[model samples]
Target chain A: MHLMDTEPLTKLDPSYSTVMRIEGVLALIPLLIAGIALYVAAEVPAWVPGIALAIAALVLVFYLPMKRYRSRGYHISDDRLRVVKGVMFHADTVVPFSRVQHLDVEQNPLERMFGIARLILHTAGTHNASVTLPGLAHDNAITMREAIRAHVKRESL
Target chain B: MHEWLRVNPLSMAVQMLRTLGSAIVPAAFVIFGAGTQDSEKFAEIAPWIIPVLVVIIGVNLLGAWLGWVRLRYRVGEADVRVEQGILSRQARSVPYERIQDVSLEQKLIPRLLGLVEVKFETGAGGKEELKLSYVSEAEGEKLRETVRALVEGETAAPAVAAAGEAGEPAAEPTGETLFAMDTRRLFVFGLFNFSLVVFAVLIGALQQFEFLLPFDLWDYLADLFRQDTIAQAGDALAGYTLVAQIAAIAYAVVAVVVVGMASGVVRTFVQDWQFRLDRTAKGFRRRRGLLTRTDVVMPVHRVQALVLKTGIIRRRFGWYGLSFISLAQDAGSANHDVAPFAKMEEIAPIAREAGFTLPGESADWHRASADYYFDRAVLQALVPGAAAMAAIVLGYTLVGLLLAALAGVLVVGEYFLWRFVRHALDPQQVMSRVGWLAPRWQIANRVKLHSVEIAQGPLARRRGYCTLRFGLAGGRLSFRGLSLDDARAMRAAVLDSIAAVDFAHLPR
Candidate 1:
């Protein structure tokens, strides 16, 4: 089987990593509080919060979001849409336009502020039934959704 | 009917009965416990218990009543709409074209009341898309007919309906009988599908609830083998070391097999009593039951693939089970069994009827390389071997050794089984055959192909191989350890077929 590799993948909006980093930091807030409480109670060493901050700064602020953003990509062709993501375990799914049951573009508060939205593609099978591509420019998400909807309608005929 | 309708008033009674049935056991247990403790104390609490029971039943009945009152459904021109939920109203509209199946179920009470539960199945698995419980039988049938008509109209064009692919005049031939099983076949099928798991569960339940049983079953079983007999056997085996251990294991094996086969036969017979399949106007219809009859209609076009399975013992008898990987959800069942157990010859006609040929014993089957075989063997053994080593280090020497031995056996067994795991692609179909204990042949029509995927992990990339996965409407098939080039080619072929969706074989 020779797969045609002419189509190049379009990378997600660069600001996606910034959104991921901000979300990650928000998640680490509780951990930071716990570390501070332990130190204030004189139970944990002063280095505890220091270590926590360093680890959070390294992972949440840098490594994870950057690595994830770099790994995520998608390609939309005339007949199908391909989404590739996964840092450790890579998955490249190609959903044929005819098979798409529905498509949706959603924006959470954070994503709305970031000017990005998520595009979801629902297919027939239970396994990998829906593929979500996050961190697309809001306008791009709408365009992609419309393009997919139009393709689905034409192919369904 | 254009107007929105509620289920029959009998539904409230049905719901109440269901609630009562579940509450009966717990209520009885409480009363029994109190009585057993002290008759005088039980008498004092008995009066209070009556009111408590009444309140419990009242609350359940009220909930059911509210649910029934709130739930309303309408049969639209091309869609079925439902408005339900008391507190948070939910409205669902399902297009007739998306309805994969229509099943009519009847329990004793509902059947007696001339009521049926109609369930609409969409390919998406989880809950039934629509359920109308305790609807009048006639109304249920009418609704089913309407949905089925819409599905047929969408698929069957004027020209195609004139003469079906089978060359049958498509005026609906009074429902052609496809397969039916007799009592003898049912008994044999039960025997072949013998489940040791059920026997184990039975023994486990007996052990756990030994006190609950009226008679002391354990004591009775012990009485079957006298103390003297056991002592005598032990003495006789003392001369040969480990002989008694082997004898005990052999005895247990024989007992389990005997019980397993008996229970298996009973289970199969009860489940599939009077099993029958017939080709209906819109699709294949199946009706069977011992206690609660189920009528499941699987629309032809909705079937994603066909699966043929045969256990080691069943294979010896040249018998195989047939099931459809369809969008149709069979209420409580996973795979809708078309034929429980049939000889290869018997299954061929049914296969052809479904627009496919039976898996031939001799075929041009393609297999992965020897490296692929070795790769599986290594992967299967690696984790277990490592676990065994860790266990040995943690002072579980004997168990660790046993685990290591089991892992070795598995790797060797897999090496042999790998030879049978192969796939073949014909013009119209792609077949994947796999298994050691139970060989399963999954065949998908090219037209049903929904999508194609190629995944390569770091390990697979290093090995110069990748996995090719093909998606159908309700199922996914994966071919592992294929060379990168072959995986790409297969993916391309599958995608091409999906793009070139054949209109001639559209689901009808």
Candidate 2:
């Protein structure tokens, strides 16, 4: 199946900028070491490591946009909850409402700062599998959670 | 209380000898070095050192005497009480219901002295229930019978009395065969344990090297084997002719078999020396040992799952070890551990005797379709394996870059194939089978499952697949390779089964 065709319509909330900053801060130590070594070592060829560090920094800079593009809004159909996620490798996962074993709503410090949340939907599988929707507006995440829970209960009966 | 029932009084002498052997080595070294270097210094300290050594030896002798005096045990109604320890004074009581299993042991020394030690396996939470250090063979048997009767009487009386009072027909307790092992079978079973050969070879090699500091002629023999000169001479002889080659091979095989036989004899004597298992109304009773005897009783209902394990070689011989996983009396540390219940050629009959229906034996087993998704997931899992393979190959072949690259590719390919073959799961009623070479099988009831989870990663989402994990009360089970729809379906099926189980009707 073509992945792009099944991509979810909903975009990640703009609050993912806070997540990008947290990731950047965590990445700062190695970035600083690379920058200092590049500046101080005149006898050594600096351009190689300098270019590598620059590429990594650039990747981190686009983290929020990439996450926003990949996060999918979920919808409950008659028998299943359809999830669409992924940007470069756009994909869809459809978990039947009756099969949902449990649901979790998590808020990390970065997400909490921006009033954003992550919704995890769990099913019974060998490896504990969950579909995480990151950078969702808190209210929307809660609403989506309740809707999934209600749908599961109704279908299970 | 009877004189014949007592252990040999000479057991104390053996203990004293052991204590002296332990103390003499260090003391001798200290005295020898000090005495040779400084006569005056040694003379000044000899009086103090000798008295201290005498006191230590005296204390050991006294301790052995007290152990003989205070080590009294009695099989009472509903429990076994053991009074032991000389200085602090200690008593242990184990209720009949709490006793998990019993073991009988006979150490070489004790056997030579015609004494046996009886040990009781209580529930996981307590220290070993009881240990009867020195008892005659016949007395030990009588004690085992009396305890078995008391346990059965205590549990049976309550049920019968209640039935009588209610004017209901008493349920007939079925007579079950408890222990079954012939000497020929034990010999076959012992022979098949290859671990004994490996252990013996390892011990022999270690002894031959003098790596552990030999104290006597044993060390001299070890040095001879370890000498490079001897090894060179042997190698020269080995290269000379076909006869030498044949002799070397024969010698190696004989060495291994001799070690294996020694190990087998020791294991058989210790584990099944005077093995006895009795069936009572409450549960099965097992007793075995040569020197240190042990007795264990396990109620039939408490047995949660029975497992039969066979290795590649053992499978050829049609031999397997039978073990059980039972509910944890305590929810803490001892969770999900297997207790060996029995070993027999066919586990089904033993399981039936233990009051449980064994799953049907079907070689035509189908992998849960979810296994395919889990299998495909291995490609993604190979990332780490590939990285490790790359590092090792690169690290070793830095001098020859082309060779390193070729090795790296081969390693990665091997890992990919191994991972692909190892990633399937089969869910069963009592147990789930997983793993590859050293297979791990886990078993529990659906009613014991506490939670379930379904998860999907970015790659898995692309494939429309998710994993389903069933978290039981004590442990967990997982199914991979399921489409989202299938995962959900499996989850509902598991939950429904869990809800339908009426635990109250299960034998308790």
TM-score of chain A of each: 0.92, 0.72
C-alpha positional error of residue A118 in candidate 2 after TM-score superposition, expressed in Å: 12
lDDT of 2 by residue, B339-442 (tens): 22244434556566655454433522224344343444455445645565566676844444554455456555445433532222124343445544434444
**For model 1, how does the per-residue alpha-carbon lDDT over B1-508 read when each residue is reduced to its tens digit?**
6888898888988888888988887568667766886799888887798788889988988899999999999988878898889899999888876776677988877887889999888655567467888799988887777676565566545634554565754234558788988999988888876677885787898887566554668788787676577778767777656876798779989988888888888888767889998987667888876757788877676677888988887788798888888764444444488887888877778778788886575756877655677888888899889999999999999989998998899888878776778888777888898887778899998767766777778777678777778776556688887777766666677777776663323555
Candidate 2 regions with alpha-carbon error over 4 angstroms: A1-157, B1-50, B58-175, B196-232, B235-239, B275-284, B329-346, B353-356, B361-364, B368-444, B453-469, B472-490, B501-507
Q: Which candidate is the best by TM-score?
A: 1
**DockQ for each numbered candidate:** 0.40, 0.06
Model 1 ranges off by over 4 Å: A1-3, A24-31, A34-52, A154-157, B1-100, B108-115, B120-129, B132-143, B150-173, B196-252, B330-335, B359-364, B369-373, B383-404, B502-508
In model 2, the Cα lDDT at residue B385 comes to 52
Among these predictions, the greatest lDDT belongs to 1
Tell me the lDDT of model 1 at A106.
92
